[model samples]
Target chain A: MTEEGKQAVAKARAILENYKGKKLRIMEVCGTHTHAIFKAGLRQLMPENVELISGPGCPVCVTPADFIDEAVWLATEKNAVITTFGDLVRVPGSEMSLAGARSEGADIVPVYTPIDAVEYAKTHPDREVVFLSVGFETTTPSACLAVQRAEKAGLKNFSILTANKTMDEAYRALKDSVDAYIYPGHVCAIVGTRLTEELTGEGISGVVAGFTPSELVTAAATLVELCSKSDEPFFRNCYPRVVTRDGSTAAKKLVEKYMEPADAVWRGLGIIPKSGMVLRDEYAAFDARKKFSVPSFKAKNPPGCRCGEILQGKCKPTDCPLFGKTCTPEHPVGACMVSQEGTCAAYYQYGGVV
Target chain B: MCVGLPAKVVSIKDGMALVDASGAKREVSAELLDELDPGDYVMVHAGIAIAKITDDDASEAASVMGEL
Candidate 1:
């Protein structure tokens, strides 16, 4: 380790220790931050008075079961080819996951990017290709580009199931209990910290940070400093190299070109107002939900899973009776266990950093 | 999952850059990020280069990460 790096960690720890007697709740709204916190052992290393909780950060974890059921409907009943990111394959729905459904002859392909799915749609015009678009600001541009590409190619067969969410909407949903937030850097990479800044307006300290171990630890300490030391809340940009105060203008423009804000349901958080993005009326030709008769059904979490409470930070993953027992990563019973970024998976994989 | 990775730019052509992320090369859109070069590092998400990191920031974060 470099001398500076050692000094940085030491300094952060020293600052963190100063607030030993005060109680604080620091929530990270990004799944990557949750994994990074566990990977760096920051949550355990913090003062016991400082409690760290994972929010509805994992897009896959937060995507409601009914959405999955709708996706299953399109893939199986409609004989459509479903292309999704690697994370969604194992997220179990009411009856089965996309992976399990694939085993039953449903055509589901996992692609690294939506462009791959767009390309697949181009080649196979006989079958309907539905890309399960699930992500935050970071992945929204790619989905937009996919629609733009599909439009340019005049491909009527290409469509998308968009479950894209905005962090600000989700933040407002849980702002009352949160003292501080470690903002997702990738989301800020495109949308910046403006929404996070608004959290500060409401007396919540928010810090945008990178994925590195020291960066997360440092950001956590900064949040502690902001909330414990100051009466005023503010947004701190700890990751200046990649994150700017105003993020990529082009990405936001593309989103406006292709998508419009809409109400969407989260797995645990329920339907947040204007939390999701839907294909704009102009790009309505590429709307998967409209093209298919995907039924609107009320989704429920697995009977014993407390993923809702876990997402809202009301309870920890271990609080769930099935967390490690019946809901191992290999056989997850809840949405929280489906993705590596999910808090349950993070806890299970990283030996309980919380 | 929002798993963005730091990747080095390998080549640029037609508004897209081929990046080497952890020894694996993949094509990423260079639309949002600016001033790209072969050695420059970027955070790649969903086949797009969302942000670019200067060498100084890269080495600083690396040194701090090295001890852990």
Candidate 2:
């Protein structure tokens, strides 16, 4: 093994050995960390008493299916071109996905950056270009900046269909039953560590960890140790190299300047108060909802898909009847299977579910 | 939570900086800082530079990990 790998294993073993025979529950809130834990074979190494549960870390899994239908509608428009990240293309809507619409005659293009969508709008001035803005705080800043750029460049045809959600509200909404939170490392880099102070007084342990196996195991071990000691909240920098107490001030400022806090509907979690963000009134012209005149549509999830339950940490992916038997990645029944960062996708990739 | 990385500013363009993070090159807005340059490491979140990371903090973190 590489030196880093060896050290990571040794550290995990030390943590396990220290917390042996202690009853503790640590929840890893990030889907990437969930994938890393399984991939690193950490579960086999840890004692049975140390339990690690999953949380709503997958942004794609939490995205409501109704939004998917909205994208499909835009794609099928006569002179509308829909652009989105690659992972969102295959997520199933109530009836079909953007991929399905593309199969039938829709102009849905996958672009790397939001700027690419802006360029596409410039090239096809006659066509209305809509970028599907999806993600948490990490990606929202750029998506907001894209809208600001469009406004500056005077691109009249460019607009974004935003379904952006924030993390602070999501964490606040989770029930008090959760013992401790294994925070997402990437999200911490944007919002900074100060935002987590709210959880400190609530007696919840918050440890920001990276996606690597070593980092996750270290975080899990730390959570177990912290929980065993007391109910007091502790913020440890497991991913100190990347995360900081202040977080990304520049990104936060840009997000604040371009976007405003608005209620956004999460697929499983429902409409969290001040959880979603929308373009400010100054940039209202770039807002897709205002620019288009689509009929009112209420999209629902596929019948018997328990993705909502799975997202809330109430059940595992394998607990669903459709898991592996009927709903594979090729034919995903819900957004969990469609997103690369979804927990179901992680479980499927890392041999958790056949 | 948010996901971001600390990257070095390699160049500047249109009030944005071309940053290098472990060989991955991305453009980040430098609207937050005034005295940034090629050798400075800044935390990047969602294509925006959010904070300036100092050499002391980086070394301290590396040392902690090394001890583990």
For this target, which candidate reaches the highest DockQ against the unseen true structure? 1
Estimate how well candidate 1 is docked, as a DockQ score: 0.41
lDDT of candidate 1? 0.83
Query: How well is each residue in B1-68 modelled by candidate 1, as lDDT tens digits?
Result: 47878899999988799999789999988977667888899989988888887534444544433422
Q: How many angstroms is residue A352 displaced in model 1 relative to the true structure, after the best TM-score fit?
A: 5.0
Q: Which ten residues in a row have the lowest lDDT in candidate 1 chain A?
A: A1-10
- Candidate 2 TM-score on chain B: 0.76
Residue-wise C-alpha lDDT for candidate 1, range A50-93, written one tens digit per residue? 89999898988988888889899998889999999988998888
Give per-model TM-scores: 0.93, 0.88
For model 1, state the Cα shift of residue A322 in Å.
3.0
TM-score of chain A of each: 0.95, 0.92
Q: How high is the lDDT of residue A50 in model 2?
A: 70
Superposed Cα deviation of residue A161, candidate 1 (Å): 0.8
DockQ of all candidate complexes: 0.41, 0.30
Off by over 4 Å in 1: A352-354, B55-68
**Candidate 2 per-residue C-alpha lDDT over A49-80 given as tens digits, one digit per residue, 9 for 90 to 100:** 87666667766777788888888887776357
Q: What level of docking quality does candidate 1 show?
A: acceptable
